[model samples]
Target chain A: MSVVDLSKQVALGIDIGGTNTKFGLVNHRGQILAKGSIPTDQYNTPEEFIDALYKEIQPLIDEHGVEKMIEGIGVGAPNANYYRGTIEQAPNLPWKGVIQFADLMTEKFGQPCKMTNDANAAALGEMMYGAARGMKDFIMITLGTGVGSGIVSGGNLIYGHDGFAGELGHTIVKPGGRKHWSTGSEGSLEAYASATGIAITAKKMRAEFPDSMLNQFPEEAINSKTVHECALKEDPVAIEVFRYTGQKLGEALANFVMFSSPEAILLFGGVIKAGDFILKPAKLHMERNLLPIFRNKVRLVFSELDEADAAILGASALVWEK
Target chain B: MSVVDLSKQVALGIDIGGTNTKFGLVNHRGQILAKGSIPTDQYNTPEEFIDALYKEIQPLIDEHGVEKMIEGIGVGAPNANYYRGTIEQAPNLPWKGVIQFADLMTEKFGQPCKMTNDANAAALGEMMYGAARGMKDFIMITLGTGVGSGIVSGGNLIYGHDGFAGELGHTIVKPGGRKHWSTGSEGSLEAYASATGIAITAKKMRAEFPDSMLNQFPEEAINSKTVHECALKEDPVAIEVFRYTGQKLGEALANFVMFSSPEAILLFGGVIKAGDFILKPAKLHMERNLLPIFRNKVRLVFSELDEADAAILGASALVWEK
Candidate 1:
């Protein structure tokens, strides 16, 4: 009989981004043993992307050993389907149509693989290792370039019938409000609550206050980070940007709370770095909008995962969670 | 061992409404053996209500025998909680604070009892025997006096942390648009989508079109049923009322679709009887608001369960579903 080394077992986690793709070999404790990155946009075809991924990850696989990967590989990508193991028409990816992502990974690596959208993976990561450690029901909102959400009900991620549930970003928060730059959907949560949305809010609001601190920087320089820096200095226009974004986010959150009645809502990504500047307004509006039964019950907090490492960690959690 | 009489095995289902309380003796096959109703508002205290229920049910119990009731009792009320088996702060009920409802029923009947809010009970009824049969994921919306919702995710009704999830009616569709009569909250779905809301809309819209048929009726006679009748006669103002209500409902539904992505959303209650006048506009607006991935996917249909029987059937289902 052979004895197993539990500590050596690891899963390969891959996060496919529009610009960069990151991969890491992680243990069950969420510690990354080895990690690497490859530019995602360089590949023109799904085949080319898979080939590049295989060549890059082979060394890590050899070092980690197939026998040690009891949990196998997990991938998180845009438009990914957990039930189908495919990426269908990902707006950001170079691939134009449905790509059998998990099938290709399994065929190349000879290990079982699972896939889910980035938001759902983040939710699993939070539930397993981060702020929502003991919660059975909670919502994870990722406020990056665009808003994304993962809903957990009855302790399980809501995949819906098509494995494409939890699209709260696209939910219309403002009817006939701001139009999205990409999807052209008006008043979507993503149009106002995201990092891109904050930049837009900053630019628009600064125009009204020509002498505001935000106008000191070039138009291109006014992003979420710049706005945060200005807010720290008590800049009035900069403060308004966060308040506007928080109101939209908080109202949408109130609707989500009524839908699933989660215990908490965990905010992630760059916009959340504004901290209480954004958090306080969101908390206030969320309370004001909620029914008395739901008011003062749902906790709104920031995620605990390291942003630079969250994607890879989140993807890896899919293997263990599944 | 003695052979069990399968045909006689039954459950006692009780549905407590604000005006009256209805109950039935039902078998496993969804057949009601006997039923009755009693005024609910006359009771001054919860204890008096329970005593009245016991007195009314005792005759039926004597006839059926305890051995025949294998499934025990299940109660559905305004603010019932399944976990704690209590009714808490029911706004429409005579009781105030928390009442140990199911515990009292169990003590009175010498059998286990379960309890849940009426809408959730209706959802269980739909899942077990009506529109949502064979479906694991669907949402139930009752559009009558108020817009009540019951969310079924992965085949189970979502009873949130405090046993109060799925309050879609309370979700605000038009911020600062309309004030709800009872809740005092502005722009709630119930303020626009319910029968009461439709009557309010009819009264407001009819003033602009004095020549419309709706103006012929007294303000007290302006309601969902009267508007439907007027629409059937090609009344323009009446038709506009449904269009406005449907628009709000559909928009709210689009938000819900993105949240849980249910396979279907079942509409019940008297308001749904308006048929295509409401359904067509609702379908159009719902599709118009949804993201590309979600458009034309979810089935929005009226529930198959008879409205009069739905509450009792839903309550009875708790016995079997448990």
Candidate 2:
């Protein structure tokens, strides 16, 4: 077989967050050659944001010149719609109301651009380059500030009727259990399974166990990472916090298994750093709750991609998706 | 276009139940031309049941003779797998182990046969001939002795990797709230939203309200139908029973909506006969629980097919599906 030069062909991936907008040039094999970021808060409008992006991204394009083939652009952001290519009323965005993000990017860069919510982009990336490779039916869950999910069924992401499916985070797992800090929803998966939720659990648990290592840190300074550090040293309070959180997460995962019967459930982002402490209880509870036919059939594992670069890689994978 | 005779074309539909096995010959317009049933209780094995079916159905085919074309066979049964075309160990059925029902049907009748769980077939029937007509993304829920569901996404039934997906009835809605008498699983949707659950609710509530009409009936005789009659007579106790059951159902529906974002959710089977008494509360609670974007978007309605014929109709629809 003739060798093909992969370095010459690249896709531009952009990840837009509440504070920062990061862009990267990625090849087909999930390699990021060049990357940069700009504060998303500086722009007053989406149009201005697109112009600023063009100004920064154009230089990177010129640096490669005619030697590289810039295939297209793929973007991942909050509240983005794949069908309409717009971001509608995202709570944390600088722009208000509906912004035609994909249209603006395509026009500014003179290339086709596709957009989807960040969780979905991460799922696509996993399908192409990460833990979910060669698997057609699975769930990609991000355990960050909020729990986010992308459900793939029969090798395709389920977009549903209005292209807003797979909001697993908001599904009530506890039923009037814990109120979400922002959405004000009661007993959602995000209210218990997220890093923010873990921190909340740590604060509550450490206060009750005064002699625990978790209590050594100041109240305001305690977080998931600090709890993980405490658990590493065999702190019972920190360990119990993860056990309870994992129990909730596992129960929710069982519900999802019953709904879609996926081949696997992949966990990603910060919460997974606790390792076996979280995974053991999660796997045990999930198996216990499922029907006998479903038990021992689903594989539960953590993501293999680096969390920092996964967003860009996933967005770029969307460019190569049919 | 030239008009064609519909009477000349027909498909065979079979619904296998615990006590009785029903079959029908249906035309393209969803009309039943011939129907019959055999006692499934008498058969010792799946092969014996297939032989009994052949003996009963051969006479109907002979009656049509050269005038009609029998296209294929479709079957709906409990614990059936679409991918494997087999019925796994269903507790209600007389068969002891896995039954290769489709293969047996194909061998005996010399026709291509497809099979799925009863609920999935109902969803297909709805899509072809009932309330879910013209809908690509929707969910079909049957509130019978037990709750059952069939999820449709992107114009296809989600059989998932294992073909054991869409077991919505078993999903835990109330977590440690109620115990399923048969499965022993606590807090499942079927534990509170089914006809069996309604009967249990009526028994518990009427015991407290001594003057209620529901107390007039014997506890063993009190079913969903009795509760409906008493509720029709403006009995507050009966009404409260449905309100509680509907509240549990509505919360479960909200969880489903968040997971799939379907265009509509169609309710079928006995419990829906309560009409607005159940519908009003289910609608209210569902909308109240949904996020802002999902609120007021999903249409919740009852199935349009006749209860007696829906099973056969849905089974026949599978023959026409691609």
Candidate 3:
């Protein structure tokens, strides 16, 4: 039997985040013909989310006269499993237990659809169209509310035996310090590198650097974004926070590099918007902590892809590659 | 050109360790037809070692009347690189520079030959004959004086971008504590997991348990074997040492499982002789530290093959698989 010409067809890629669910129609070339996002709260149930998604996305495919050009749908949800085709208990997402979100999409729209965890999807996206495009072995780290990571080796995502291999965020940069959700231990790398963790660190440091410009913001109001903004203004405390956060991230990455020496480590997320604040310190600390042989060989690069578009492109590319 | 038949062909496998170098002729079924080990001396030059190896091995091949029956030769050495077909600056070996060890054999006997790091050879061995015989994505860790590891993914060894992907032993467990050379950090898992490292930990903990039965043995004379013997006697100090060693190893493996997620982690070496004393605690701690999703999934199994012959079979299997 002749296999269908999937390589020429397009796919719908969706990224469901806490605030918004982004959607796009993408072709095999990693090009997004159209894209948009709808507030996640607009849909209370899984059925409502699918309906709202179709309403927002149908027009894009129709506008481009590519409705017939579409072959499948691919989704990147918070806790999705590519193997199971379900999102299981994503803390940030309102869903509970296993949600056969893929079945719902196919039942309603009649298309072949695939899904993977958000971090893995992002990694696939980066490999398909972003900083790591054309690269086979690399890691994508999203320094967001909490640390989430995706690993690609030999052009394949390392989903382990159970499909949850890339948990780079909670690798215990600090053995037993701060309590983090991923690992029960305290002071994990995620506890320090993530947005919420950074905010907590900023609040604690606020007392030490009260005379510094970081004191201008209240403890409750501080976030990774504010810290980045203040660091850019040369606020000593803010700069120190980014430096410390990067140091922890870098050290943890060094350990990871030893396990699988990828060509590069691509960093993304709102926290990374601090640019050099996090990148410079992270590189320094990582070099200091890395094995001598791997010190200069590995590149710690940044992702250039836009977050919303990246997810869609990645999800679409998943189907394209298959 | 007609391809050579391999059904009856055998391969000669040699494992060069610090103390003894083992040699064997193994058939395609991973059965050893002949085998022996010769003491490796620090004072001997590379040329002398090869000469001695040939003297002992030639008779075995001749006695078995297998000169034409042998297909190739494969060597697994302390710091061998398959791509380079040479040993480059192995830590335990006195060799200072690059040595074309495989070429030396091929030149002497005019047989096809290949070489790889010992741990990688073991992985290929497992893939060909032992516990991971059919496994594609798994890691093999050898816990001797120091820890060494090899990775197999997608039915082939992951050479990584640089032929060094499976350095699991070196993946840091303690980021800022006393680092062993292997893991490139202070307080690395290797610092406590390797036989030498475990001995060190046992020696240090000996002070804390001075009143314990283990105190009857002199601290200077304590070693991993003595500690194991003591643990057999239910010595609390020895048990505690293994417990700490298992805990640290388990936590370190938790980090590794997050990266590779192989079907099983195959453990080998003298330290493993303690069996359940080491494995039971290690598994318990590993399960505890593992991501809730990966609690009891990744198996930490031991190699069932005889330790003395496993390396020879593993090395021979390398050529057999190719």
Each candidate's number of clashing pairs is 0, 0, 12
Alpha-carbon runs more than 4 Å astray in model 1: A1-5, B1-7
lDDT tens digits, residue span A1-322, model 3: 9676654478888888888888888877787878899988666688988898888888888788877778789888887887778888787777678799899999988888898888888899888888898887888899988888998888888776666678777666776778875557655678999998899888888778667777888767799888878888888898898888888888888787877778899998888888888898888877776666577988989887886578788777677665
**Which candidate leads the pack in DockQ?**
2
Tell me how far the alpha carbon of residue A140 in candidate 1 is from the true structure, in angstroms, after superposition.
0.4
For model 2, residues A76-163, the per-residue Cα lDDT tens digits are: 9988988899998898898989989998898889889999889999999999989999987899989998898899988888888987
lDDT (tens digit, per residue) of candidate 1 on A254-304: 889988889999999988989998999999989888989888999998999
lDDT tens readout by residue for model 2, B101-152: 8999999999999999999999999999999999989999999998989999
Q: Model 2 chain B: which ten-residue window has the lowest total lDDT?
A: B61-70
Model 1 per-residue lDDT tens digits across residues B19-64:
9999988887788887888899999998899899888888877876
Position B174, candidate 3: lDDT: 74
How many Å off is the CA of B39 in candidate 3?
Answer: 3.8
Tell me the spans in candidate 2 whose CA falls farther than 4 Å from its real position: A1-8, A66-68, B1-7, B66-68
Candidate 2 CAPRI assessment class: high
Contacts from the true interface found in each model, as a fraction, amount to: 0.71, 0.79, 0.60
lDDT of 1: 0.90
Q: Can you tell me which runs of candidate 3 are displaced by over 4 Å?
A: A1-8, A181-183, B1-7, B42-48, B103-105, B179-184
